[model samples]
Target: MGFFDNLLLNLDASVTGLFGQWNIWTSLLATALVGFLTYQVATRQDPDTHPFLLARQAQGTAVRQPGESPVYRSQAAPHGMLLNAGLNVKDPGASKWSRGRDGDLRDVWRQAVAGVQEPGPTKGAKGRILTVLGAEKIVEHNLDDITRQINLIGQHIADQGGNRVAIYLPNSVELLATLFACAFYNLTAVILPFDQPDDAVISMLRRSATDTVVTAPGSFPFDAVVKNYPSLRQLIWVVDEGSKHMDWNEVPQGTGGSVNVSTWQDIVNDAPLDAGKTLPPLEGQKEPRDVTVFWQSKPGQQEEMVRFTAGNFVSAIAAQIFAIPTSQRMGPSDLFLPADSLANSHTLVLTLAALFSNASVAFNSVASQADDLATATGGIAPTILVATPAALLKLHTESKPALSSFIGSKLHWLQTRSLTQKGMMPAAGGLLSSYYDRTVRPALGTTTTTTTPNKKKLRLIVTAERVGADTPKLSSAVLSDLRALTGARIMYALTAAKVAGAVTQTNFYDYRVFDDKCSHFGPPLTSTEVLFRDTEQYKTSDNISQGEIIVRGPCVAGMEAALGVAGKMREDNTLAYV
Candidate 1:
């Protein structure tokens, strides 16, 4: 008893001595530390997705090739189940319980016209189509008028015996309507890059075996196209409203009646007033024709024609539709704009998906240019913007140097913490944002002028890196910086030449910066599976599976394509090029 009492007494004495030495400053400091810790614990947030889910995002096959790694697929499709195949397009009057057929491009227009169909009390609604003329002019087209144009164009092409038609115009109402016209009329649509040189355009025509050509009046060398390609049968000139006063029907002197020529405006005007009000009747159950795209491995390389069947495109569209969580899926309330050229398959697929979801779409003629992103999206604010890595890199590089001021740097650091540590996007603008805008943005010079309008309305920025294209690399740190600056989430995709949409895309909610050099492309999409072909130097048995990437799925042009680039599968099952 005496020993216990003495020990207690000594402990109490030590505590009293420690407390007795504490002054007002020390006591205040201790209280502040305790309160800060308590506040932190109370305000902490859960990550966007569970960590375990990220760890095992994809599944591996039980068996593997002799020297290659086991095939990896999205968790959405396991070993025994089938991968995503098509859009599951149900025909009109088909049983609600029956399985849908793999629909063609005609069905895409039908769905857009049908509008949003949902259960319960929500009524169906259609989305508008907007065309940006320039910084000051935006035109909204009526669906009925667009339908009329489609019918006139389709009937004209079919009557002229045009089989394979090349659409060589910039992104405009005419381009979209002509594409749909070909779909409805069962003619193959060949998409050629609008910016190619005259010789390049002629070469593409010969290579694609295109019988019909649709383009602007003065865009290409008309005489050269007719002289070099004897198979050309029809030419439709899409004259702008400003230049329609000039005569565009003049053909070369020696051509005679062999080549039939027409203007888009004349075709629409010549049709009866009530001709194209309603859609043409479905032509029974026949499948639509193929859609061909030109693929260039790099600049100055010969372009190759890649033909994609309706099944390939529909499957890719469906895959992209379901890639996002159901709660976050696009709907009628959103406006989607593709700042990149729709000639790129990835951009085209996403645009179609947006249309299918009943979202408004905007097109700009300045698309596909690296430095014209701001000019393309100047007036309207889009909820979703799809662009190229070059465009985003330009934005990042230009805006970075302006944030060197002490206040701007501190604000950037706080925003970075919100993204990196908290897994949440910072609020778009606040008092601090106003202060930064006035002080820091002025230093940005012309960059401030080129900044996207109403940036606060932007919810997502989708950009991709073509595998073999000569473009700037987007590092994870740069992506993090972009996220901080834009106040919007970014989805970085890795696309290949043979894949319809994308080989793999980063998770929407994944904001981690894994490496400073290259960001990891997330798991294979649900529409496809990926495997690495083992090489002598980089084998599957290494710490990380490394080799060439092999992709296979319905979205692939040939059902399987080998991406001729070195890649590695990380421990977390993400993919990154070596």
Candidate 2:
């Protein structure tokens, strides 16, 4: 007591001496000065934190600041702008997606890749670019390497008279290179889903009129499948080593030896670096790289080939970029993991979105089950995840409860809800992350039922493509449980089987307003235009609530994604599922 009292007496004396001479007004003024200086430093260092992003900072809409992230928050009364609150469709001539080079996906992709060339952080190959998974070692591809491969592969297609090339392999860096090569050479890429049965694949091959099939070294019974379809003139095996691949001599004989087997290495390695020189310039074509992605209307039914043009791809990338909050925007430093098969529209587009923004992409198995989801999340620990509602639901149901129902309710209202109403402090980003600084790891034998900790926490990129919005269980509400488990901010979308890509997506920052109970697929993407007509999609008797939804934009259907899909629209400009 004697020692503690002496210490306290000394501390009080020091505090009194320091502030006693300063009046209350002076102390308050000094505090304000310090706070102002702190804010100034933070904004200057991180431009995204500045209040006006869609306004003044949008000066270079496509450009990202070096070192600092583009995602930001509001200092006072903070909220994101209604990117499409009102359909600014007064002038049909004013469509930005249709303005340049027809706003083709090819051009947009080119621009997005170019944007990354700036002196800053990046991921991928050759020069710390994209990273490919499934290899015994790490593989990266730079823009130059990708371009070279594209030109050579494009040249190969031109020489083979192969107008349509089908890729039937798991996610890898080579698949991306091939798709870009198709875009580069003005050839149509036919992508076959990797998960389909051999019979389904063979049927789709014949139906697609595919001349060549690209696949991994040991993927399926390539010989048996291709034998059924004589139109499949070639089977190109993907091998990291040219010498190790089964040579043409070892390949199975197709009908009349019409099928020529080659390795991806042989095609690219043998071509000259100046292969693109002889190819026709993209400007000369009336239409550019057309892609045919097969969608099975049902599991056992015949596949429908939905064609997408470069322009549609471009619009998709641009609109997707606009949809991501600057705070959550994909950057060069962030690693992207496409857990779902790249065959899915959402997965492919998001991959391109990351590359277009100079971010890195990693591969993981198609997350169709809870185990797969857990493995993918834990293996990659991705910051951005592109998955379907089914996978998300699986993870939610499989997860060990962090809080009991009653305690969860208490935290939801008392903690998560309150902080969300007041914008998330940039400093609080870690609070939702596994690296949360405030909480200490509990020792063994401790039973902290209220705290559910995820060592690999990640945000979500989900789609409502096949979901029935009116169905309570399968609707966006399914993701509510998942969000609470991982503190992941989900950006859900209204994607359709027939649609070229995303029709509507939630604003990343706007998740808090509409919590976990109901489905909230945000407004239409910037490049898409939507309108509704009376249809069965309108479950509600209210005249304004339901109707068949129609969209016209670069991300629509048709070769250039200039076509539209049928759906229902709400009065608030959101798309209702058909």
Q: By TM-score, who's the top model here? A: 1
- TM for every model, in the order presented, reads 0.92, 0.69
Please give the distance, in angstroms, between residue 293's alpha carbon in candidate 2 and its true position after superposition. 0.9
lDDT top scorer: 1
**Which 10 residues in a row give candidate 1 its minimum summed lDDT?**
442-451
Per-residue alpha-carbon lDDT of candidate 2 for residues 384-500, written as tens digits (9 for 90 to 100): 677666666665555434344454444444334423433332333533333322232111112222221222335544544543222223444444434544555677776654455
Point out where model 1 deviates above 4 Å.
Answer: 1-31, 93-95, 120-122, 252-257, 283-285, 427-456
Each prediction's number of clashing residue pairs: 0, 22
What is the Cα-based lDDT of residue 336 in candidate 2?
69
Q: After superposition, how far is residue 501 of candidate 2 from its true place, in Å?
A: 1.8
Query: Which parts of model 2 have CA positions greater than 4 angstroms off?
Result: 1-137, 240-249, 253-256, 270-286, 326-328, 365-371, 405-415, 419-460, 467-481, 512-518, 536-543, 558-573, 576-578
